[model samples]
Target: MPELPEVETVRRTLNELVTGKTISSVTVKLPRIIQRPAEPEVFAQALAGQTIESVERRGKFLRIRMNGLVMVSHLRMEGRYGVYQAHEPVELHTHVIFHFTDGTELRYKDVRQFGTMHLFQPGEELVQKPLMKLGIEPLSSEFTLKAMTDKLSRRTTKIKPLLLNQEYIVGLGNIYVDEALHSAGLHPERTADSLKPAEWKRLHEAIHETLERAVEAGGSSIKSYVNGQGEMGMFQHQLLVYGRKNEPCTRCGTPIDKFVVGGRGTHICSRCQRLPRVKKSSGEV
Candidate 1:
């Protein structure tokens, strides 16, 4: 799944490619991808003649602001968007295409078909099903140290899983979560509520730093991830932990370990991030 950095990259690229362009028509080859208005045909019809004014992201969802409506799109695993000339042949995976007035098109292709699009009225977008439930973005000013600490205080779930929850801290997925935890020298299985103030502070900084660095590197291109220009991300080359399983840890020379945490493949350095003592007392209590 595309995480915060990946989605942010996509948003930047799509904004440049599609904004201010008017939609002349829409073709939805896969009806199941449209989840709004209860009809796929309506999804296509509603987009016709509307101009894409701006592109914004809430967590993993992409919001394309049109004249009077907002189109919320969630690009699930392996989903991507591209801009093409009218003569460009659409890929076999391209399930949706938005024809523009100037002999151009914005195409959506998803191998898994898990991507979704929901069109809502101007002000009703955030109230709609997907975007309404999303939580604060980690990079936003509203996500403060106090906000993170308070949210962490309520959960006994593993730190990684709790961080993965979009409602708790939007835009973190497996790759970045692993990198953040590893960077903070924290174990993935550490209980969320057990985090000390210092630990939370470290985690917070690591999250910000990891994401900022990833965005700067254009996000990690683990596989098939690209910007609007069809270019691969450079962050993968700088990854400290993700996809480095069995490789030497950059800090401690220890072999990086990969394991499943909360059903997600997680990576960490055993030496740098020691396993939390299972029976350690909750020092706070």
Candidate 2:
């Protein structure tokens, strides 16, 4: 799944590719991908004749700001968007096509067919089911150390899963979480409540720094990730620990290790992330 950086990259590319363009028509090859209006016909009708003012991103969702509505889209996995002339042949995986008045068409393709789209009234979008419960973006001013510590305080879940929870902190998935923990030198299995003040500071900084650098690098292309213009991200080459399992650690010569934490495959430098030995108890944290 694309994390914050990847989503942000796509959002920017989408804005550049299709902003100010009027949607002449919309075609949904896979009806299940549309979750809004509870009907495919309504989804298609709502988008028709709507001019896309801009493209925005909230967490991993793409917010297509139309004239009076906001179309929220989530590219779950293997989702990509491209634009081409209307007469041009559509690509193989193209699932949704928005025909523009200028003879251009924006195509959405998802191999897994897991991506989703929701059309809502502009003001009601943030209050809707999908966007209402999301936590703060890492780069937003609303995110601070106090906010991070407060959210993690009452949780007995391990740090890795806690970080993975969208309600706790939005826009984080397996890859970036692993990278953040490894950057902070914190064990993925550590309990959320087990962190010290200093550790929280480091973790917080690591999360922001990792995400910022990633967005700057156009995000990591670990899988079939690409921006709206079919551009691959460059950050994967700069990854510190996400896929370096069994390879030598970047800082220390110790080999990187892989383990399942909270049901997610995690990578870490064992020497840097020396998880504290704790007796297995009924609490299981």
Candidate 3:
């Protein structure tokens, strides 16, 4: 799944490619992808002749703003959007097509068919499902040291699972969470409230630095993720520990270990991020 950096990269590319292009018509081959208006025909009709104002992102969702309506799209799993000439043949699993007035087409293709689209009025999206429950954007100015402290101070959940919760911090998936935790030299199983002030500061900085660098590299393309231009991200080459199981750690020579935490695959260098020792009962080993 594409997280913040991946989604943000797509938004930037789509804004450049599709902005100012009027929708001549819309075709929804897979009706299940449209969640709003409950009908694919209504969705196509509503978007017809509307000019695309801009493209924005909230967490993992894409907000494609048009004249009077906003289409909230979640490219779940392997969905991808590309701008192609009208004469080009549509590929397999191509579900949605936005025909532009300039003889170009904005096509949406999903191999898993799990992508979703919800239409709404201008301000209605923010107050409704999916978008409403999203927490602060990590890359936004609103996310500060104080905000991070406040969110983490009261939670006893393990750090990895807590960070993965979208209700607490949006845009962090398993990949980035593992990378961020590794970069901070913190164990994935550590409880949130157990961190000291110094550890908290390290974690805060790690999260920001990791995400910024990933965005600069166009996000990690560990799977089939691509931008609107059909280009793969380059950040995977710079990963620290997410997928490097049994590989030597970059900071230390310790072998990276893999395990399951909160039901998600987690990787870490045990030497770098040692788990806290638990006090045992007097008779127990």
Candidate 4:
């Protein structure tokens, strides 16, 4: 799954590639991918002749803003978008195609067929299902240390899963969460409330710094992820712990470890991110 940085990269590339282009027609080969209007025809009809104003990203979703409608698209798993000339042969697994007036086409391909598209009137998108429950953007001005502290102070959930919850912090998935936790030198199993003030500060800084650097590097392409231009991300080469299990830690010589936390694969350096000791009952020991 592409995290915040990958999604943001796609948004930026789509904005450059598709904005201001009028949709001459739309073809939805996979009707199930269209979650809105109940019918693919309605979606195609609504988008016809509508000019794409811009492309924005909310968490892992791509918001393709048109004349009067906002098409919210979630590229779940292997879904990707690319622009090609009309004469180009449509590739395998291409589920959606937006034919532009200029003889070019914007194609959506998904190998897993798990991507989704929801159409909405401009303002309603913000108040509706997908976007409504998403939490603050880590890169935005609203994500302050105080804000993070306030949210985590009341939750007892383990830090890894807590950070992965879209309701609390959007755009984080297994990859980035592992990277962030490792960067912070915090154990994945640590309860949120167990964090001290200094630990909270470290976490807050780590999240921001990790995400910012990943975004700059175009996001880690650990899987099949690519930008709208079909470019691979370079951040994976800079990763410290996510896919480097059994390798020596960059911060310490400890071998990186991989285990399951909150049902997701987690990576950390045991020496750098030591779990807190638990007090045992007097008789149990």
Candidate 2 on 166-208: residue-level lDDT in tens? 9879999888998899889899988988889999999999999
- lDDT, model 3, position 101: 98
Model 4 ranges off by over 4 Å:
280-285
What TM-score fits each model? 0.96, 0.96, 0.97, 0.98
Task: Compute the lDDT for candidate 4.
Answer: 0.93
Best by TM-score: 4
Residue by residue across 160-184, what tens digits does model 1's lDDT show?
A: 9999998889999999999999999
Q: Global lDDT of each model? A: 0.90, 0.90, 0.94, 0.93
In candidate 2 the C-alpha lDDT for residue 235 amounts to 94
In candidate 2 the C-alpha lDDT for residue 64 amounts to: 91
The local lDDT score (0 to 100) that residue 48 gets in candidate 1 is: 91
Expressed as tens digits, the lDDT of each residue in 1-285 for candidate 3 is 999999999999999999999999999999999999899999999999999999999999999999989999999999999999999999999999999999999999999999999999999999998799998899999888889889886788999999998988899999899998988889999999899888888888899999999999998899999999999999999998989999999998899999999999999999999998978989996
Which residue pairs collide in model 1, if any?
Answer: none
Better of 2 and 4 by lDDT: 4
Model 1 spans > 4 angstroms off: 278-285
Error of 4 at 28 (Å): 0.7
lDDT of 2: 0.90
